[model samples]
Target: MKKKKYNTLWLSFLGVTAIPVLAIFIITMVVARNEFYEMRAIYGPNFIPATRESILMILIFVAGLILVANSLWMIWMKGMVIKPLRDIEAAAKRIAKGDLEFTIVTQRTDEIGELCRDFEEMRRQLKASQDARIYTEQQQKMFISNICHDLKTPITSIQGYVEGIMDGVATTPEMHSKYLKTIHNKANEMNLLINELTMYNKLDMDHVPYDFKEVNLKKYIDDCAEDLEDELATRGVNFGYRYNCADDVTVKVDPVQFSKVIHNLIGNSVKYMDKEDKRIDLRVKDYGNSVMLEIEDNGMGISEKDLPRICDRFYRGDSSRGKTKGSGIGLSIVKKIVGDHGGQISATSKVGLGTTMHVILKKSAGGKNG
Candidate 1:
């Protein structure tokens, strides 16, 4: 038979309780039985009967003592060892079954208590990791859903326009031009969405392909503003530019990606422009160690609730930004571009008024002032 772990302790205790009592009974029996006649010769004939009764009493006492010792050991083992192990075993089984919600507790200041604490810590970390995984999964699904929604609109329009053209619905030359133009625009929109998604994914993975060079802040802003002016003018929206920075101050940035940053910011502003006379102001200011570029607009502003999360990826849940159907990664792309250049982007806005986007970049020490 396989002896339990506590049996060793029980046997050790039996050495003191049962063994000694048994030894005493054996010794008493031998001495009483062997020394009977000698003691009777010394004392009286009645000693034999009395000695027999004393032996019976010793046997009873030893048996009772052994029984009591076994009983006490059983109770001690149940309370101190067996019950605690059973509790831990049950908890382990629950956790093995993927039930991380249960808790393990220990009041003793022993090794078992330390073991329980470690188990609890492991459970907590497991729960946290599971939650993070679930959140990532949800975000991925939302990304796919949002991308499909944005792509379907332009795709559907392109398909309809192509069908119209095939059916000869545009009978006149002007109608033909208009139908082809609409198809071209829809295709362009789809292309832009695809490009934004690709860029956002790259930025998210920190796989930036930048060509950093030191350029004069003043000159760069001026040239960029000129381009922005011409572009926005095409849409009948005015563009304003100002430079309040030192002429010699320079900053390192990837010109192409930085241009995208400007465009994205301006694009977001244009998306919400609601006034009859829409205008976007681009301003650059010197701040000793760094320079700040601000893009302000006279468009319908972002709500306070939306402003904080406007730059989050796939964040089209806002009331204002949702007014236009987009991939919702515009601000995310802008934020990533600015961050990659060791800069920060922020915004300030009021409902029904306008919004200003501020980007801060560290100034390069010395460069040719263009």
Candidate 2:
């Protein structure tokens, strides 16, 4: 389309320029014919005055031709080149003044049109970058605010517990022990928050170290589930495990970091459990090239709106916030760890039904059994 328009523009300019030149040619021919006949009739093939008149007529005709040509050239240039350039200049000025909304419209197929298209693309990219920067700034501010509040909650608790112990309020040994334990728990929470912050910083900086190893998936998850079984049982939650893989099924992973992933998911499930038949199920399945680990729970599920952002740093679901305590970076850390191990994680849930967390890891080349 633009190519056709460009060709058409050149053709039109040629046509416009030809019309005046053709008119001037006809006028000069008529003047020369009249001068020839007038000189012959008036002076009988005269030499001096007739020659003077003819010279004057020729000069006038040349001047008129020059004037017409100049006028037409100016008109053509203004329409084809100057106006578009002026538009571009004006748009540029507006952009310099921080007005990104200005648009440059052109119908030329020449260099100027290409320039306009490039300028538009640049403006769009700038706008997108500005928007992303603003969003990131807003998110950072919100994170800082939430971190301060989260830290304050535990710090305030620790301070209160310490004050109680110092004031002789816990005169009994049991009371003293309880207060000290509370203080310890609060301190632990603060430490966990700080640790999560540090881990997130490392992840952001691409500096989190991993020690990858090939391990049997069945035994690995079994051990993890077994470690949590006692705790779940003590809390009256039925725990179940299913390993639907061959005996030799294995995956390469950083065991410690991967274990953190499992722990965080199970901890989240336990924290949100509100069912009469409280249950946590751990399942492992072997795909041809990968293994899947799923931890599901009969807990208060996440809303559809909140499910997508659950793994984002410091994003706490409204339902989970009131019933449980968390540093809000656990799932984010889990996601980062899974990603670093060349795996993926996702969650599926329906409100009031249950939530299932899935982790998919590539199978190790050496599928050695435990």
Candidate 3:
């Protein structure tokens, strides 16, 4: 559409400029013809005008033609070239001044129009990059604030416990032992926070090493669930597993990192248990070329708004913040580990019911469970 408009402008310019030149040419031709006829009648058939007069007339005619043409050419250039160039120059100046909102509007079909289009595209890209940078900086600030706040709680607890022991407040052996254990637990919590931060940085940098192997999916999940049995029991959470696959369904994955994924998810579920009947179900189901592993819990579920961002780094849901002790990067680490294994993870939850985490992994090429 813009090209067509500019093409029409060019045609209009040519037509307007040609009309005056055509008129001048026609008037000159008519006057010259009339002068010749008059000369023939007054000075007989073979007569010609005096050389001086002829030269003067010819010079005047040529001068008038040149003057009219030059004026028309200047007008055409001003409208077609100078004005559009000035507009582009001004738009560039505005962009350099950080005014990205300015748009270069043009109806040119030539090189100038293309230049404007390219400039607009560049401006849009610059604005987008600026916005992304701003968002990242804000997120970084928030992450630091959250981490400091998280660390402070544990550090404060450890300090108080140590101070109590030093002041002889824990006089009894049992009291001393309890205070020491409490201090140890607070230190452990701080260590966990630091570990999460380190792991997140590794994941971001793609530096987390993996040792991939083919393992039976059913056995892997069963083992992982069994390992968590004692922990679940300690929290009064009933844990169960069901394998809906044939004997030898297998997938290639990094065992240690994959274990982390399982532990993080199960731990998250345990941390958020709000019901008396706390239960977690780990299930492995076989599809034709892939397996679906699920860890579902009857704990407090995520809100719809927070569910989408659960796997985002440093994103702690409002409900999860006061309810659990975490740096909010566990799910992000889990997500990254799963993604690195060429699998995908997702969560579905209702606020009051529970949250179900689903991991889908492609079956090993040699593993057939038929």
Candidate 4:
């Protein structure tokens, strides 16, 4: 109890007030008889020293006790309560004044110390929140600026072509049709940017609405490949799909979001296709407790520096093969969706050769869910 932080104040009170009082009392009793005669001489021969001496002793003892108590109270109040409160007050003022450049220090192990520590923790958290808010605001501004920069080019091109048609600059029927097609393409590009922005904002979270359901992996991917083959063929790109997994291989995934992930991956491959003999191959395999999906493309591969950051939101590379690499959020969406579904996505690429994207999803319990 004596070693406790709160109990020490009680001990200090006893030492300064009650213990000193007991000592003062004992000394007065010891000297009472001797002081009686001295009191008689001082008061006068007829004076009643017996009663009056007792009064004087009581008065002196009471006065000394009051004086000691007042001194102790002043000392304790200044050191224990007042000084700490003042320091905390100063800290509050500094924090209120928008300054977070200092630290709080205290050596006492009492309630004051705990209060100081808590206050410091609050300040530290507040500083961190403030810093994070500032960074987020900066990133938001950059995002808006990037969107504006990208939108300006297409918007200007569309305007110029429309003006050309109106100004009769596209006089021939062929020129008019070409101008109309270019304008339509530019408008589509703008719409794609808007869609990417909307999707990115939705996926930039930990708890996206993932409706997980068990599905045979091969059959699901086969359907996806079937849908994409016709589209790729229209663009003169060959598409292939392979499965080395068991017929009963199954995994839990959100059907809608997973389809987007597949399309986005292939979309990137098609976007970077630089060779006339464009080709894309997708394969799936069972790997113990996880299933691996790979998409390889004969496209202009990402450079060493850009490969690492390719999936980062709004990151654009130096490759000029694709007219514009898009709004730069497709692969980020892929990663986000994959991670939300308790999976992983990665890529490997070499410039001028090709690239392979790997996605691994945890196999469902009872892998052969037949």
Best by TM-score: 3
Model 3 stretches with alpha carbons more than 4 Å out: 1-38, 41-95, 99-125
Per residue, candidate 4 scores C-alpha lDDT tens digits across 222-334 of 89989999999999998888988888888899999999999999998998889999999999977778988999999999999888978877666867423564666788899
lDDT comparing candidate 1 with the true structure: 0.84
Lowest lDDT 10-residue stretch of candidate 1 = 314-323
Tens-place lDDT per residue, model 3, 72-186, is: 8768877787788778788788888988886777676899788878888898899899888877788678888888888999899889989999999999999999999999998
Instruction: Give every collision pair in model 1.
Output: none
Sorted by TM-score, highest first, which candidate order results? 3, 2, 1, 4
Report the C-alpha lDDT of model 1 over 1-370, residue by residue, as the tens digit: 9965565556766676777777888888888877887887888877645668877887888778787977798778777876777777887888789778878777888777787788888888888898877776877788788778778988899889889989999999999999999999988988988898888989999888799999877788889888888999999998888898778888999988999999999998898888999989999887668888999999889888888977877776466434677766889899889998999999999988999999999887674333
* lDDT (Cα, tens digit) per residue for candidate 2, span 181-275: 99888888889879879988898788978888888777888788889898789999999999888887778888887898988899889888889
TM-score winner, 2 or 3? 3
lDDT of each: 0.84, 0.82, 0.84, 0.84
When 1 and 4 are scored with TM-score, the better candidate is 1
Cα error, candidate 2, residue 261 (Å): 1.0
Worst 10 residues of 2 by lDDT: 1-10
TM-score for candidate 4:
0.64
